[model samples]
Target: MSIPTGDVPIGATVLALAEGATLTPVWANEIGGFTFRAQRADGTTRYIKYGPHNAEVSMFDEAERLSWANQYLRVPVVVQVGADHTHEWLVTEAIDGASAVDPRWIAEPRTAVTAIGRGLRRLHDALPVSECAWLWDPYSRIAGAEARGLTVPDRLRTPPSDDVLVVCHGDACAPNTLLDDAGNPIAHVDFGALGLGDRWSDIAVASMSTEWNYGPGYEDLLIEAYGVEPDRDRLAYYRDLWNAT
Candidate 1:
C-alpha cells in the first residue's frame, strides 16, 4: 500500500536493481528516496528502497541494523543491498501488514493508536539493551546531530536520565508500525536509526507522531495502551530532542 506523493518521478533505473522482478513505484520521501514494491514471476513480493548517497540516508547502515535487530523483533528481512557512486539501495522481504497510518487505520484512530503504543512497548520489552551493539544515548545522539551540521538547542541537549533504558526503535512514528487488517500491529519497519536508548526516546516520538499522522486527542490512548503513566519531563525533553536531532 503506497501513498502517492508527487515529488519524484514514478520510475527509475534503481527499480531494475533486482533481476527478474517488475517494480511498481509506491512511495517517495522528502530525502529524495523512493520505495518500490516488486513482484517476481514466482509470486514473491519484495520492497526496494533507493536514495542518493549524499542524502545521508544509508540503506547499507539500515541493512546492517536490520540484520542485528531481526534476532529479537519482527521486522523486514534483508534480501540484498547494492550501491553505486551516486546512490544506494536496499531490497527487503515484505512484512505481513500495512503501515499503521494506512487509510483504513487513519479513519480508526483508536485502534491504530492503541496498536502503535502496544507494538512499541512489545518492541522495547522484547529487545534487551544489554545485547544490542549500537548506542542511542544522549551523548551519542547529540554528537550525531552535530555531525549532521545541525545545532542542538540547550534545552534539548540534556536528556531526562538513563535510569531506565530500552532498545529504542529510533524512528517510532505511527507510520513505521505495520498493522494487520484487524488493526492489530503485526510488525515494525524502518530501523535505520535503531539503538539502545531511554524508553522515552521511543515513547515520546511514538506519541507525538500520533498527532502528526492521526488527528488530535489520541496521545493519551497510546500511553494507556502502553500501560504506563505519563512522564511529562521525559516526554517534553525527548520530543524536543526528536525534533532537534
Candidate 2:
C-alpha cells in the first residue's frame, strides 16, 4: 500500500458517502481500495475507505476490529459500515496523527521507526487476548493463502513455538502506525486482519517493514524499543512465513 499521488477518481458511491464534504485521497492499497479524508464545512472530519468486493480484504471485518480495539487502544471510531453486491465501504471518525510512513516522517526514520516500535508494543500490551475473537495464527494464515490459491512452502507449515500471545495488528507495517507531531505514536489504523497471535508475528513484520520504508540497520533499534532481545529463530521464521503467505 502507498499514499495516492496525482489525480484519483472519485466514485459516485464515494461522492454520495461524502455528502458534499471536501474529499482528499490519502491511501491506496494494492488491492484497489482507496481511503479518503473527508472534511466538512463545519470542521468535522471523517475517513472513508471504499473498495470492490474482495475475499482477501473486508471493510466489515475492519470496522468490527476497530470497534473492539477502540475500548483498549487509540484507534479510529467506527461511524458506518455497509456493503452491496459489488463493493464494500467503511466510515470512521477522524483521529489525530499522521501515518509513520508519511513524507514528513519518512525524512526522519529514527523517529518514525522508534514510534512504530513503541506503538506496536503498546498495541500488543493493551488489547486483551482473552477477549479477542479473531485469529491471525499460522494455521489460519496458511489456510488463507491456500484459499487465495497461492502455494505455501512445506517448511512454512511448521512454525516456531509461541513466545507470548497477544492481539496482533495483522498489518503492523510502518504505514499502519500513526504518529503525533511530537514523533510519538498516538494510534494505529488498518485492522482488517487484527486478531490474537504471537507477538513475534507483529514484531517480525514491523521490523522487516523498517527496511522497506526507512532502509536497513534500524531493525535492532525497533526491537530494543519494543523491549525485547532479538529472537533470531522466531524472527526468521515469521519473516519467511510472511513472504510465503
Candidate 3:
C-alpha cells in the first residue's frame, strides 16, 4: 500500500457516505482499495475505506476486529460497514496520529522504529488471546491461501514450534502503525487479519518491514525496543511463512 497521488476519482458510494463532508484521499492499497479522510463542517473527522470485492481484504472483517480490539486498545471507532454488489465500504472515526511510514516519520527512522517496537509489545500484552475468536496460525493461513487457489511450497507446511502465542496484528508492516508528534506509537490500523498466533508472526514482519521503509541496520533496533533478544530461528521461519503465504 502507498499514499495516493494525483487525481483519485471518488466513488458515488463514498461520496454519499461523506454526507457533505470534505473528502481527502489518504491511502491507496495495491489491491485497489482507497482510504479517505472525511472532515465534516462541525469539526468531526471520519475515515472511509472503499474497495472492489476481494477475498483477501474485507472491510467487514476489519470493522469487527476494530470493535473487538477497541475494548483493550486505541483503534478506530466504527461508524458503519456495508457492501454493495461489487464493493465494500467501512467508515470509522479518525484516529489521532499519522502512520509510521508517513513522510515525517520516514525521515526519522530511529524514533519510528523504536515506537513500532514498543507499540507492538503493548498490543501483544494488552489483547487477550484466550478471548480472541480468530486464528492466524500457519495452518489457517496456508489453508486460506490454498482456498484462494494460490500454490504453497511444501516446506512451509511444517512450521517451527510455536514460541509464545499472542494476538498478532497480522499485517504488522510499518505503514500499519500510527504515531504521535513525539514519535510514540499510539495506535495500529488494518486489522482485517488480526488473530491469535505466535508473537513472532508479528515481530518478524514488523522488523522485516524496516528495510522496506527505512533501509537496513534497524531490524535489531526494533527487536531491541520490543525488549527481547532476537530468536533467529522463529524470526526466519515466520518471515519465510509470511512471504510464502
Reference-based lDDT, each prediction: 0.84, 0.93, 0.94
* lDDT (tens digit, per residue) of candidate 3 on 1-245: 88899999998899999999999999998888899999999999999999998877588999999999999999999999999899999999988899999899999999999999999999999999989999999999999988888899998899888889999999999999999999999999889999999999999999999999999999999999998999999899899988887
lDDT of 1 at 150: 90
Question: Least accurate stretch of 10 residues (summed lDDT) in model 2?
Answer: 51-60
Q: What TM value does model 1 have?
A: 0.93
- TM-scores for all candidates: the values are 0.93, 0.98, 0.98
Consecutive 10-residue window with the lowest summed lDDT within model 3: 52-61
Residue-by-residue lDDT tens digits, candidate 1, 1-245: 24655555644556466576877777777667788888888888899888778433478878998998889889999999888887788999998799898789989999999999999999988888788888877788888888889999987766677747888889898989999898888889988888989888888889998988897999888988987998988888888887787
Angstrom error at residue 79, model 2: 0.8
Residues 80-117, candidate 2: write the lDDT tens digits: 99988888999999988889988999999999999999
> Could you tell me the lDDT of residue 137 within candidate 2?
95
Ranking of candidates on TM-score, top first: 3, 2, 1
For model 3, how big is the CA root-mean-square deviation?
Answer: 0.9
The regions of model 2 sitting more than 4 angstroms off are none
The C-alpha RMSD in Å for every predicted model, in order, reads: 2.0, 0.9, 0.9
Estimate the TM-score for candidate 3: 0.98
